[model samples]
Target: MSAAPKGNGARAARTRGPVHVIGAGLLGASVGLGLRERGIDVTLEDLSPTTVALAADYGAGRVRTAADPAPAIVIVATPPDVAADAVERALTSFPSAVVTDVTSVKLAPLLELTRRGVDLTNYVGSHPMAGRERGGAIMARADLFVARPWVICRDEATPAEALTLVEGVALDLGGVLIEMTPEEHDRSVGLVSHLPQVVSSLLAARLVPATEQAIGLAGGGLRDTTRIAASDPELWMQILGANREPVVELLDAFGADIAAFADALRDPAQTGAKRRIADLLAAGNRGVGRIPGKHGSSERFTTITVLIDDTPGQLGLLLTELGELGINMEDLRLEHSPGAQIGFAEIAVLPEVAERAITDLVERGWRTL
Candidate 1:
């Protein structure tokens, strides 16, 4: 939990200004689009003229050409290496305005800015913990940040007005605010964000030489595990490079875990080896428990799988029937088989609704796999 910077809510409200979203990438465009939808004036900018134009065309905001006036709140959403420079440019471009960023690692960028004697008062650091594996403005969604934790890093010199302005933009975009120190943000993300990218990429990279038959056999588990491997390499390089130390530390720990897991598998001692592997798996299960439950509740889900044709309208029809049944789906995934018309759709619901949903769907001529 973070204490609000010393300021009255009324005073902070009065100081709000037009939000300028820089970079025009997915994260930036999403923020701009969401804010613009709230009737807030938003200006968008990107180094590439085409990107800026496309993002504006996508309803992010009006393009901030050179002739436009300086914006009130400037958000730098560029790569990690360029983020501090972008923030400096924003501050220079809009002297009286608040400035922040959507970069993952904060400490390195903050340190870089500090070395240049930049005005820290009007600048705060922010990282919205939401993104897609895809990149660019075209993948932007107005609700990308909805209900996600948007972490803000503030120092003593950071102005209350500046921090509040950023939080206001976050709230307007339907995000919950979280705060931490710059170093804390960097270390935490190195584990949660950076490490996952590296691990997923490593896993996916191994499939390059896999036989077509083997690759074709991949299912939901493999897809879910390696989904982040589809992320933009250029952007990830910058992020991982900037947060190298903490990421390296985490990688070392993960490497040790992997070695232990391997040793457990190779060991001939039956009981002890099985116990070792069980302990590692139990640790993983406990870690997963720390993650927020569906809709923020602790209740477990009961999953029901329905097999259907893989043709068009089949998925929609199934969902329509469930909708008409007034049965809410907690989670669902389609498992399509290769060279087969039928696919299994796994649907998750509340435990009490699970058996009932299965029975109803099956009674309606849908196959429950």
Candidate 2:
């Protein structure tokens, strides 16, 4: 339900009490930091007292003692298997607050909430569509959700006030709002999110018994392909199980593509069939175009790498120098090889800005490679 007409294309202001974040993991901690940065009083809670204290120490937000009163906006960010249960507890723990969950699997949790007779009026389902391979609150960032799509699953019984609060939360976190039915959210994620997990794991699994010489030949392409394999398996098992149906459908489609490629490899005289292989690769190129451009614009980018010494103020000094040079970076990645004292910082910039950045960094006594 839409709020009453108000400002110039802005979400309704937060009218609830302090936002309470549960789980104290990466997503939970990031949410707390983002909310507090927006001037919203945020409190973090976790099942383990020590983890909760650690999150508080990392500035996720003030940790709530067990005896403290419940907060108004309760965000459940636990694993998918326990998200519904956590949501139920949160709703019951704070009856007046608008409740939401940050679980990836939406339909299963929504159905569970409905079946368990949990109040639906003050609750809605949300997935921020962002995460990292690393875990824990120490890795949290306030800008983590910036420009990312935040999926909101709407239902008939979802209260207008609850939607307002959810939208406010996303907006304050710098996330773009996208509304979808729970079924739609599940299907879309299965194609984009779950399918990639399966593919990355399959690729990574092949390297288990490889020789040292073969592993030493690994390049950025293989690194890119298998990066997501480092994700926590326990969390993925719950996600895959929760969205099994949709993910299975996508895997079947992927299997067909793989089969076609296999047939192309075996055929020696089929010219037309070989062209099909080329077309398949071209299709991937086209698909990349469909993804949103950086910062919501149509701009594209290329990445450049700079080697920086691993020492205090090195990263900060590099960033400060880049600012002085007025070079805008699109994206950046830090990489360090085993037993190496220096780290490679991969920075993405607009193609037009690449040469200027390289020249500026070299002039500032920074290595381009």
Candidate 3:
């Protein structure tokens, strides 16, 4: 979960208590809330007085005061642009604290801080690989970081206790700890996170002038590809700008793939064009297969779309029936039936068992689409 704790004293000290979260937005509030859930003392601060109050009101923690004791760790969850400033302030304000930040882009802020000659001793750059499409204290969830990777960037000079303190809090919040240099973290996220955001947003932008009929015909494929496009544009702009080097490199590579794919499809008559298209598409198939869980390669399983009423309890009843049938569903995806009071449950099962599942469902009065 995305909840929290802190550390003080020895560098290797396990998280002690009283985590001061700077920036009471989604990540900060979620950290406070998660820590508070574990009965850890947390203090909240933000540029917006109202935002901090809202977070505190939601039981994240009390609003910070000048009289409060120094925090063992300060989590700077501000936007990437101002992250260095916040981290610098935190390090100066709480000299004894092991300061960490959850900003997306890792290297820029680190460089900025180094440029300012801030002592690198107490500052540890970190980023939690977790977030929601929409962000705010209202969207904060205690379990946001559960099973997600929390990357800690430690230099050779980083003390064992400082690393332990940051890692301990990450563990307390159910994050899987990953150690990386700042450069590695930035490049990895550029490929996996930032590049995709740009692609999805551009793809969704194409639908803006489409006719209602054309748009209404969109299906799961479109939805899956464009879902992240709904993310906060302002936030993404800041992130993309901060990580421009890696993200731009990634976008260029990805754009080349798109151009190649489009050129092949434009005219099927060219020699080797069909094969090029197939190879590119097959590459996508192989890539998708590498992804974890429900969207595994179609070669691994056969999906049967069962039609059913969209009313409450109906989906649960289907799942209950599935268990009763002795059928094991490897994965499942759901889609709505537009303008109809029904939904489609696309259940993936081993090819060997798909026929029996569909037959059994049909026998139990379910329709398949």
Among these predictions, the greatest lDDT belongs to 3
> Could you tell me the TM-score of candidate 1?
0.83
Candidate 3 versus truth, CA RMSD in Å, comes to: 6.5
Off by over 4 Å in 3: 1-14, 293-336, 343-369
lDDT value, residue 160 of candidate 3: 89
lDDT of 3 at 134: 88
Query: Distance from true position, residue 314, model 3, in Å?
Result: 8.9
How far out, in Å, is residue 49 in model 1?
1.5
- Name model 1 segments beyond 4 Å from true: 1-15, 294-306, 313-335, 344-364, 367-369
lDDT of each: 0.84, 0.83, 0.87
Show model 2 residue runs off by greater than 4 Å.
1-16, 66-70, 294-304, 307-343, 347-357, 365-369
**Per-residue lDDT for 99-157 in model 1, tens only?**
98999888999889999998778898899988888888998977778677899998787
Q: Model 2 — TM-score against the truth? A: 0.84
lDDT of 3 at 236: 95
Ranking by TM-score: 2, 1, 3
Worst 10 residues of 3 by lDDT: 1-10
Q: Clashes in model 3: which pairs? A: 3-34, 4-34, 4-35, 6-16, 11-161, 12-161
Q: Score candidate 2 by lDDT.
A: 0.83
